[model samples]
Target: MKRFPNQIIRLIIPFVIIIAGLLIAKKFLVPASFGKLGHFRADALGEAMSKPIHYVGQQACADCHDEIVKKKAASYHKGVACEVCHGPGSAHVDSPTENKPPAPRDRGFCPVCHSYNPSRPTGFPQIVTVTHNPGKACISCHNAHDPVPPHAPEQCGACHGDIARTKMASPHVDVPCTVCHETPTEHRMNPRMYVPTIPANREFCGKCHAKDAQSAKEIPRIDMGTHGERYVCWECHYPHLPQVYNGAAK
Candidate 1:
């Protein structure tokens, strides 16, 4: 019995000392930049993090940003979550001025989740390449929550009135404007949507005008040589007047 008491006392003393040491260490220990367990602590901490400021959910935005929200609702991104595009905004909401979070103000921050490339929410493969700056972030040229498609005409003639007039009356009017001037992509304006191998686009026109083509036996073959290889057939055949033989008429 006497020996048992001594053993119990010894074990309890060490346990008490260990608990005391832990208490002291806990009191003095400063939080790490990423907290005590680093990445391990992130998940638990993330749950407790500050909410967002701007897109206080789609409903909140819909209340104030009615026009923008309406436009976005009609876009391909209607299914995407507001936070998915805007990022967490609790800090900004809690102390909007004191924290002055970047989400509300900058494009770079928006890229974190709403990447310029096809991110999680923007799941469409074609939509991924629809960025002015794919290397940067989604927010660079776009407001992720309220994305807008490019309005600029894909054709060179859009700005060049003379070319526009000539092409409008050219025989090649059947062709799409984007077929020549605009870069090839699944989606317009998105660089990532570009096809790695777009076979000879000019050859498309050759398919129709075999009689006027270089290989044709009828009209003395016009040897454009290097120029023909590089330039589209539409460059010579006015789009507005595709029937008019700009080259040696067959």
Candidate 2:
């Protein structure tokens, strides 16, 4: 090979020296454990495994609070785990006297799962806080362990006696109050002058009675496409007494 020119040799020497210096530094500077687990430190897994567990689970809590567990079993909250609202119980279990788990009395506690989030399943009971119970604590109206009310029908009748009586006399007596009136959870907690708005649109009535092939045949169904779109369902047939003659003679 022909010898490099003096200018080229000067430029090449520094690059070769710099690469060699980097390799030497890498050999000494990098930790021995690094790259043992695909660029992670091998000892990190051991350190994490050595740390103590924080959550003791619902079973561990049931061992000490059998009475509360029994009460919960009979209530609507039976499916909810104790530790979900109570927090991790391991610290409390280890030192029961000193590390008592705090009571979940805050108004915000129940709404964590109960608040009306659109992503939540449609069947889950949820409420809009401002409309449901503006300033009241949940525990004030709802029992902590057994949140569901006992006499719902009677409670509803107390305020809406006229509507309740009309509903009872109507053909749709078997239909539940909640079928038309969404539970006014806020109104129950704190009395309000206005109740939740009742829908009078054709689509609202169509939910149960639309003449879709999929709808239950035992119940009345109407074809909105052919049926006069100008008139609402209640205009001709009173919702509470749909079977009774209330409209003008045809």
Candidate 3:
């Protein structure tokens, strides 16, 4: 081959040197175990395993809190693990004397999970905290372990004894007051001036009285097209003691 020109030789020498330098640097710079486990540092697994465990699980918690676990098991909140509210118990489990788990309070505890999110499943109870109870803790009315508050009728009756009596004697005795009125979680916490809305429309009645509903067969069903269009349901029948009357005279 013809001898390379001085300028060309100089350029080629620098390029070869740069490639050799990169190869040498890569040998020292790249981790030895990197790619040994397919793009992950093999030593990282050992590092992670060496770190202390944080969560000890619900079974570990139940060893000392069997009573609480028992109540939780029977309640709607049975699926919620103890550590979800209580935080990680590994430290506490490791040394019960020194590492005590903090007690969960009402500040932002319950609403963290219970607060109204439209994306939550339909059966999950959710509340708009601001509208429900402005400044009250959830524990005031609801049991922390069993969670489900007292029956609506009894709770409503505790304050509205007269209305409760009237409702108990009415045709709608079996129906819950919450059916027509909404008592948000906040209202249950502090019932100061909370006046539940009494819906006075035919469509409200149509929820249970609509002839189209398959489940409403056991209850009175009406044709809203013909029967209840002219007047509100309460216009003809009393809300507490609904009774069918002849003609629109009432």
Candidate 4:
């Protein structure tokens, strides 16, 4: 019995000593630096990890960021709250220590409400068609802080350099790129802006080719008629402007 008690004491003494050492080390270690030892304070960690907290319910966010709430009001998304598209964010805000906020996946977040049907203009390219990756999120290019699409097609050229260069070489280069490409709220150009109300018709081509239009008026110009559905004004008119418009019918 005496030997058994000594053996137990030896075992417990090591454990007690280890615990005391931990306590002493904790006293010396700063709370902020405790992460170095793999110890994180829930409150501090929560604040540190707070990265705009995906969809933390617009209401809760509005409570703090009323300015954003006011700006977003009366916008297309006003009917929808932060959680409608972002999913549940309360758990993340409340217990972010254990729960990690969902990744900012655009396709996944949008499809929850938007559909491919024509009724939903936002889904035109369809989440799947535009972004092959379902995990892709819309906010990647869009800033929720300033929900309005502030970037124009010129800005889009940053990521779409090839398209931008190609467009620069096209006859339509004179037109501001945004005239054709629009944002979430306005995607398609209004057809009426074209003279013929048809983008491919001769009248549509006359809008900018004022000189050609005047010459054609006096010369009874050739009725290209969209080149028998084979080519449009772009095919004949060099997009590089005066340097490219050689005055040749072809």
| Per-model TM against the reference | 0.28, 0.45, 0.48, 0.30
lDDT per model vs. reference: 0.55, 0.79, 0.79, 0.54
* RMSD vs true structure, all candidates: 15.5, 11.2, 12.0, 19.6
Residues 92-137, model 4: lDDT tens digits: 6676558655544544555555445667653223334354444446
Best-to-worst lDDT order: 3, 2, 1, 4
Candidate 1 ranges with C-alpha deviation above 4 Å: 1-65, 86-102, 113-145, 149-250
Colliding residue pairs in candidate 4? 105-137, 106-136, 106-137, 106-138, 107-136, 171-239
User: Tens digits of per-residue lDDT for model 1 on 1-250?
Assistant: 3466777989999999999999888677734444556545555666656643444566755554588778878665687755564565555555656864344555445444444453353323333343545566455565655566546346545434675666666544555555554555443444344533433566665554444565435332333444466787767654456554556453
| Model 2 residue 51 CA deviation in Å | 2.0
Question: How many pairs in model 3 have backbone atoms within 3 A of each other, for residues 3 or more apart or on separate chains, i.e. clashes?
Answer: 1
Worst 10 residues of 4 by lDDT: 189-198
- Provide the lDDT at 210 for model 1: 48
* Candidate whose lDDT is highest: 3
Q: What lDDT score is found at residue 212 in candidate 4?
A: 52
Better of 3 and 4 by TM-score: 3
Leading candidate by TM-score: 3
